[model samples]
Target: MKLHGTVPVMLLPFRADESIDEAPFRKQVDFAIEAGAVAVCAPGFATEFYKLSDPERYWVAKTLVEQTARRVPAFVSTGCGSAHATIEFSQYAESMGADGLMVVAPKWCALGVKELTAFYEAVCRSVKIPVMLQDADFTGAGLPAKLFVELAERCPNFRFAKLEVLLPGSKCAEIIHLSGGKLQVLYGLGGVAMMDGLAHGATGMIPGSALVEVYAKIFRLYGAGQVDQARALFHRLLPYLVFALQHLELAVGIEKRVLYRRGVFPSDRLREPTLHLDNDYQKQMDELVDAVIGLVNEVKAATATRG
Candidate 1:
């Protein structure tokens, strides 16, 4: 049930008119695996959860899991506007053979921590695989440590968490302590604070900035006992990542665009309500991708020289 690692939140592939595209979806899956993703995720947000109908969401989840085929763990987000809907998604995902679920908090109702505990306990009981508590940024709501601990203790599949809060330094440690360090923590904000999170006892990262290899370099180096080297690589990769989404209205759109500009995808498509980057912003993101690609090459060269 331990779920802490660099789980890439998949970017939904859409066509020019913004409908789902299957070709690039398969490619994205292959790319992440080849790059050594610990897991591949299809969160509601990553797959444009907003616009998808319940059936659509299930179909997407089913196909993604089928395609991955146990090559990596699959975490599909199961947060809906209601606890009932969330439970539905969770149970359905488990039935579809997903290894685990990422249950985000309710956005509209904005339940308190006590309510959240009840919610998680119910959903976790409903499923057989692990569940990752995703109580991050949803209309000023956060999952406090007490509730997390309660859920982890009572819920059957409750094991991991994805902390997406914006709170500054050492706040993560506070949550860990509050949870008695029993919960497995993953940094879902990608590369930001990954090093700090690791130092504070986080198990792994779910970095969206890792469409390429620089992100992998850091994770590998850090895992292989090269702490100082990983830190330096993360710092070098950070600016390029920050720049890619700096001026974009929707960061997901920027991420997809970065992949597109690199020719990883022919069309930098986004589902409706997720607009394309403005022309100038697009150009800026292109430059950012160029830098990231360059960073990967530099690291590869450095590694080769050491060898």
Candidate 2:
């Protein structure tokens, strides 16, 4: 089966003193699985990947693979500025039994298509598992449709692409059409455009892990042809989704805080220099969740019925 559905970009839990809180992090993974996520991904942007050291990065990947233990696919972001480090991390993830890898374009300098393609080709060549290109405008090196097509055609392992752009539905559709459905497309942006992306032929989504059950409901409802129901749920989720995307750098902190509020995370403490919402924003998020409680319960009923 393809790696599909609400694959959460997990948040790394932290202790009061800023240490990695391993226990809560693992439980967060279990919570996502119990909530019906088709796969679990970690050390993505939401996981504070940039803040993690080399050893910490490997530990997160290792822990995710071990905890998931094949319950669902496990993917880790292994992109680095140089091909050698990328390959090293990619191979390490494969060694640790990761199901696949998500790689963004090399950073610090914008390179031409030829250099970008060569970078991806090198990483794909070094690993046997599938590789996903993370196409995000924030990366300053978003893959154009043509370059994406070339990567798909040139690398057999290049089988998935996750788009993090505005108005992603058309881009999602174009990728699906241009790649002949050979490359499965997913969208991010806290799933604000999830329904639109799905309608445009995205196979699935990879949103933050705060409310995996809700996202799972949307994905399952849509796939089951309950289009109207899915749209309703997606709209219900927009308040929090909008809040989550308010600041690009603060997205992970917002997710961690929500998870903490939901009791899925031990604490919302993040590494230094991350944002923390004040009481006002917290009250807003609380109200948003309150408004959606009924819909959330309805999703539970719907999921049980479908099962």
Query: Which model scores highest in lDDT?
Result: 2
The residue pairs that clash in candidate 2, if any, are none
Quote the lDDT for 271 in model 2: 93
lDDT of 1: 0.73
- Look at candidate 2 and tell me the lDDT of residue 22: 91
Error of 1 at 175 (Å): 4.2
Return the lDDT, model 1, position 132. 86
For each candidate, what TM-score against the reference? Answer: 0.89, 0.93
lDDT of 2 by residue, 160-247 (tens): 9989876777777788889898999888777777888888998778888877888887877788899998898788888777876888
* Candidate 2 TM-score over all chains jointly: 0.93
Off by over 4 Å in 2: 138-141, 292-295, 301-307
Model 1: per-residue Cα lDDT over 214-295, one tens digit each: 6667777887899998898788767665664343335676677666765567776666554555789667767776777777
